[model samples]
Target chain A: MAIDRSHIGVVSEPREIDVEKGQLRFFAKATGEINPVYFDEEAARAAGHPTIPAPPTFLFSLQLGAPAKRGDIFDPENGIGVDVRRILHGEQRFTYHRPIYAGDRMTLTTTTTDIYDKKGGALEFITQKTQGVNAAGQLCVEMQVVTVVRNG
Target chain B: MVSPVQYVDTAALAVGDRLPDHAMGPLNRGTLALFAGASNDHVPLHIDSDFAKAAGMPDVFGHGMLSMAYLAQMITHWVPQERLRTWNVRFMAITPLYATVICRGEVTEIFTDNGERLARLSIGSWIDDATQTLGGEAIIALD
Candidate 1:
């Protein structure tokens, strides 16, 4: 069967994820980052942000959608054998439209962009892009996330 | 003004030591493209100079996860592999490619769970020119 090229740009349901302080704080410590723009509200304000901005890699927490909901591409029931334990992060890439702030409201939409069959395991690519906007409708951030799956 | 922290003793790094803050430069399209090529991420938004302008960005942007990975690389580079059990990260903000960004981290809590010492870590990257860009926490196990 030929791969459907149109599916690459297919849109999925909009997933909403709230931004909070504690989780952002935890992420900062875990990555060993000390940028004041992530922690100091005053500093962020002085720097012209609405509030303290979270780190670049914090997009993984936003539950854009579940694997099953992603259809046969990530379907654990039938399509590909879904095994979590044996999986390793193959790679991740991000392209930002703007910066994000603490009080920003974020909406994530995920699409099963692509899938490849490897000799050892199936390599799946999931792209979740979160678009954040302030109350003023100004775009604050554009976050893109990807992950790899391996048979456990 | 923020003051740089000088750790007196490496052993004194408890579960709550915060690293000194540092400033990065203004990000640009050229730098973002460099990172994209170096990391093998060729998304048009990150490399195609014209595409970025079409998308309304001044220039191509950097990969947020790449920035996160940079911090991860820093941690592993500073600490030995034997002291690490596992590492993971998430990208929260759009770290523009050529934009200058400040990366920093802190130790929140440390504990021994199931016969393994673990460190709760927090880290983030901020666009120096802009206000906020990215941040996240990690769980590190010590052997």
Candidate 2:
């Protein structure tokens, strides 16, 4: 089964989160990222940032605070009518307009941009984009996530 | 053992210079679980082996972000975190658990664009098999 093309352009509710130093530190450690700017506020300031700037790719973790709940795509009862087992991550892209600092509250808005298939419906790819804005009303990052579904 | 990002002087290096390669793992289940908790991506493909097998996948596989983290490690280990402008990755293959993956990158070009000097790099990771599990390019603003 192909992804419901009609689901394209659907926007999810925005999720708000407060960036925490300890949380970022834990992520940084788990990724084996040792940049002091991610764990030390003073070091970040020394580098001209107001607070600890999350390391690149750290925003991925923050987005989980508002992942798509069942039914949006996987809920058979009400969702886009696709099997969860057929999906795979196809691509991920991130663009940072500015560094996200510790203590910065952010709002993430996720939207599905496109849904297309390849090889006569054997493979389908869904393109989704999420924009993150800081409390100061500045754009922090834009992440594009792609989900590929295999239809047998 | 978190270390500081060391800024680099672009003039000091040549276009052919290879950035330091970060060789990581024998990645195990424990590390994969820790990454799942840390990244908040509890996707069953990376955490639930039975679920993955049910989905026709070979047990549970590592998250693509985990390999990206390895790429980030290669970058931050060599260049200061602040100097990095953009890094994007394409998931080429599944990096299975317990496989040692080596992240490698080489400076391809350094040029001036719109008053900003940037270095372009061809980055990839090798996972035991001859083929790379992940590959992509990156642009970093120079100091």
Candidate 3:
């Protein structure tokens, strides 16, 4: 089945998240980041950050905390109805306006930006754009994700 | 010991300069499990061999985000994290289990935009056998 093209331009409700120091440390370790600013508060402070700054790409994890929109293309019942097994990550992009500290609170919103297919419909791609805004109402990051579904 | 924060020397930088290579893993199940927990990406395709087989894959594989994180580490290792203005990657192939991935990048262009010096880079991650698994571009603010 084709993805619901009508779902394009749908915006998700704002989802809020607290950027925790522990999560930042864990992510830094898991990714083998040797940068002390990502783990040590004193080092981060010395480096001129308010606290442990989030590792690059850490926001991608936080973006997942957003509440799933109804009729999401990934949904099996109300949307594309494709098997989760067939889905693969296709692309990811992040544009950062400023470094996000662990103590910050962020409000994230996602929009379905595009839906298309390739290889004669054997593959389908769904693209979503997400923005993270700090409590100060400043835009902190913009993330774009593309998910590919193998129609085979 | 704390590593001092550092930035790429913009004045001496030139197009075709290479960023230091960053390598991680002969990625095993433990790494996958840890990444799954940390990244909150608990997809069965990445951590469950049976589920992966059912999905037509030979075995469980690493998450694309995991590779992306490693690529980010590569960038931050060369320059301070705050210098990153934009990062992007396209998943070109499935990173197989136990593959040691090396992330690499080259400065393709350098210019000033809006008074901030910036560099554009061609970046990718490859397996030991030289298969490119992820490819993309990144733009970083330079001093």
Candidate 4:
């Protein structure tokens, strides 16, 4: 089944999330990060950070905390209609405007940027761009993800 | 325990210089489960063999984000996390279970952008069997 091209440019409702120190530590440990700045607040301060700065790529996980709105483009039924099993993460990109600290609150919004197919419709791709802005209204990060769905 | 960190001198860096390789794994179910919980990505395809088999994979595989995280760790080891301007990756292949991954990066270009020196690096992660599972690029501000 072909994805709905009309979904392009659709934006999700903004979601707010608090960055927490414990969660950052957990993520650091999970990824085998040994950097003290990611684990110890004192070390982070010593390293010239205001607080425990989020490790690189940590924003990707933080964005996932937002609840998926039903009938969104990722939905298997009413949205793109591709089965969940068929979807694969194809590409991911992150452009950081500023460092995100653990004490910050970020507002995240995702927009469907593009939709297309390849391999004669055997592979469908959905591109979505997500931005995280701090409470002060400064953009902290921009992430673009490409999702590939296989059709048989 | 806080470990000793050696920050890279980006000003002294030259193009074609390779960052130290960061290696992790022989990834197991525990790592996948821990990552799934920590990252809030609970997709069963990473943790459930049955689900992966049903999805046409022989077994559960590592998440691309997990590999990307490792790559991020590698980049930060060379420079500060705050120095990262951009990072990107493309999933080239599925990383099989128990495959140890080595993340490597090479500085491809160095130049000044708006008075801040920056280094653009070509980065990728290779499995123990030498399969390049992910390819990516990163740009970092040099102090």
Best by lDDT: 4
| Candidate with best DockQ | 4
Q: With candidate 4 superimposed using the best TM-score fit, by how many Å does residue B118's alpha carbon deviate from the native?
A: 1.1
Candidate 4 per-residue C-alpha lDDT over B1-143 given as tens digits, one digit per residue, 9 for 90 to 100: 45566878887999999999999998999999999988988889999999999989999999999999999889888888888998899999999999999999999999889998899999999999899999989999888
CAPRI category for model 2: medium
Q: In model 4, how large is the Cα lDDT of residue A99?
A: 85
Residue B143, model 1: lDDT of 46
Clashing pairs in 4: none
Model 2 clashing residue pairs (backbone): A71-A75
- Give the alpha-carbon lDDT of every model: 0.52, 0.79, 0.86, 0.87
Give one clash count per candidate, in the order shown: 46, 1, 0, 0
TM-score of each: 0.45, 0.90, 0.95, 0.96
lDDT of 1 by residue, A1-152 (tens): 22233445555555555667665565554334455555677756765667776554444444422222433333454333334333334444434346555655666555555555454544444444445554566654454445444432
On a 0 to 1 TM-score scale, where does candidate 1 land against the true structure? 0.45
Q: Which candidate order results from sorting by TM-score in descending order?
A: 4, 3, 2, 1
> What class would a CAPRI assessor give candidate 1's docking?
incorrect
Q: Give the TM-score of chain A, superposed on the true chain A, for all candidates in the order listed.
A: 0.68, 0.87, 0.92, 0.93
Ranking by lDDT: 4, 3, 2, 1
Off by over 4 Å in 2: A68-81, B1-5
